[model samples]
Target: MTKIGKLYGVGVGPGDPELLTMKAMRILREAHRVVAPVSSDSAEGRAESIVRRAIPDVTIERVLISMSPQPVQGRDSAPTGGTSADQGGGTDGYHSKDSGYERAARAITTWLEAGEDVAFVTLGDPHIYSTFTSIAAAVIRMLPVVEIETVEGIMAFQSLAARTSTTVCDAEESLTLVTAIRDTSALERHLTDGTTAIVVYKGGSRLPEIASLLRDTGRSKGAVAGELIGLAGERVTSLDNDEELPSSYLSTVLIPSRSMTKTVEAGEGPA
Candidate 1:
């Protein structure tokens, strides 16, 4: 039997090339090809953009992953749960990502059969709300013996905490990472009495609604947001500004829930 090439899912961290882990960089340097997932909705590849700095000389392959939660054209509505384009790991529960995951699985298999190590790069940690899980799940189902290694990277929220000088949580205070939801009410449901921190991913172009929701829920002030963190032309500002938020699909919002009493004092995010 021919040996299958191993697959590595590397989280390149929250947009700063410096944050890329050593193990991830080593894998990138050694991999035969790096697969960067790009959104069908946009021309940019956030993961690939960050990894390129580490493996500038390696061959980087672009794969289109459907991140949209809107029912894909011509397909029946997806069953409850994810698509690969989901902000952190996979799409939120609204849309199905079977097609996109299957496509990526096929691509990874092709590269492996060719005896090439493939690095599937992601932003932040590959395990946290990342499309990596969906793709890896599909690939494993198809080729049971293929070896896979996932390298962890810093999450966007963690970076956001540092950039804004905001504390994520203290002691037992709760923290929630929210990706997508159907409506304002549903979004509010996640904010528990104990959740001290809430990070909203894929807050793309939904700033007004999110901000309104936050205000309605009593988290009226001291929220921070960031877009394209650690990248050139990156912007970090307070949510207090009247600026239209979600400047890019890559935007994130960090709101301090009512439970938080102490403050870190730095928040540069779009509002």
Candidate 2:
């Protein structure tokens, strides 16, 4: 019997090519085939861009997948329009089958069945709100015995924290991570839930509302927003200045806990 090739889900980190982990680079270079998702045939996905930067001469296979939020009516069918990779940053919401996971899975399966090791490169960590999860699930359903492995990559929030000189959380504190894509209710709740810190993702569209909520909840202090981290047009600024917030889908907002902010202000720094 012919050996079935394994599938590796590789996280390419945020936008910086230098951030790609050594293990992920090795897997991508060694894989029999490398698959990168794209919003359209002409547009290069963020993950693909990072991979190309790190491995200048490497060839990659591009798969078209919708990254836009799916409509309620056609949740199961493929969505029509351009797709975006996870790192491309956009409004966040519940994903649907229309995102084209099944199609991508089928294409990947063909290569695996041919005994070709396949690496699916994604932006950020594969386990964190990544499209890789959907495609991997579909592939598993089709090929039950297929071998799979995941490689961890640095997330945007971590990069944002580093850039802004803010600590995500300290000892005995809780951290809440959410998306501000479709609604701001959850984001509001987390702000007031006694959580030590809150990281809002895909919040570029609702920056104003989020800012208001932060003020109303008295969590506005030390709030920072970052866009296009490690990429062109990158901006990191205080959320206190509404005019400075970049209204791009790739924005990330970090609301540090009041206690931590206070400590930093007093020159005590994070414990």
Candidate 3:
């Protein structure tokens, strides 16, 4: 049997093809197989989107992991449009990432068993709210001999802060990073504890609710919204309360770590 290949989890950054790290680029260039994640909501894969542009000349076998928030409607049938890999065809009754942990693990295992290096591409950094970590854990159990490597990429919060020219922290200031949700209880908790700067990632669709949540806390005026970070059609909207909030899952909200101290420091203001 051929030696098992290594599995690498690479953070491709947030939508910016240029933001892909040198290490990630090198691995993608040299890897024998690559698995790009495609969300259940859309056929388009942001990780694959960046990969296609960044390494136009590279060639490798690739797989698509469709992670759906809910059970996929079609578990037995192949998808209408996409390669076999895109279809995620499996003998087992697994369809979406939610139920396809074993399938994904087996898929990566197949490549590794062939002595092929595999790179699992993810958006932004893998450590912060990424699916790669979860999938990797399952894959490891399936293939105990497989080696796993993790590469860091620029995070959405860091990119958002840079694009808006806002300072995330100023020496000794603590920052809260969490997912944006409709419920304001979490936001209320942070504010109650005197937290100032918060980076809400992956909740672009909840902008209005987020805006309202901030308004309830009287922190709506200084909030900043970043969408599509380094990619085209990027928008950075600054709110001052009472303004309409647009929706985009690619969106990120930046709130000053505190009241009366956080103002726009500088960078590209509003798209």
The TM-score values for the models, in the order shown, are 0.82, 0.90, 0.81
Off by over 4 Å in 2: 73-83, 86-98, 267-271
Per-model lDDT: 0.72, 0.80, 0.67
The TM-score of predicted model 3 comes to 0.81
lDDT of 2 by residue, 132-165 (tens): 8878889999999999999998988889988878
Q: Which candidate is the best by TM-score?
A: 2
* RMSD to the hidden true structure, all candidates: 4.6, 3.2, 6.5
Candidate 2 lDDT score at position 133? 81
Q: Which candidate order results from sorting by lDDT in descending order?
A: 2, 1, 3
Better of 1 and 2 by lDDT: 2
How does model 3 fare in lDDT?
0.67
Q: What TM-score quantifies how close candidate 2 is to the native fold?
A: 0.90
Deviating ranges (above 4 Å) for candidate 1: 40-44, 66-89, 93-98, 192-195, 259-271
Question: Which 10-residue span in candidate 3 carries the lowest summed lDDT?
Answer: 80-89
Q: What is the lDDT of residue 104 in candidate 3?
A: 68
Question: lDDT by residue for model 3 over 82-133, one digit each (tens)?
Answer: 2122212221222354455566678888888889898988778877666677
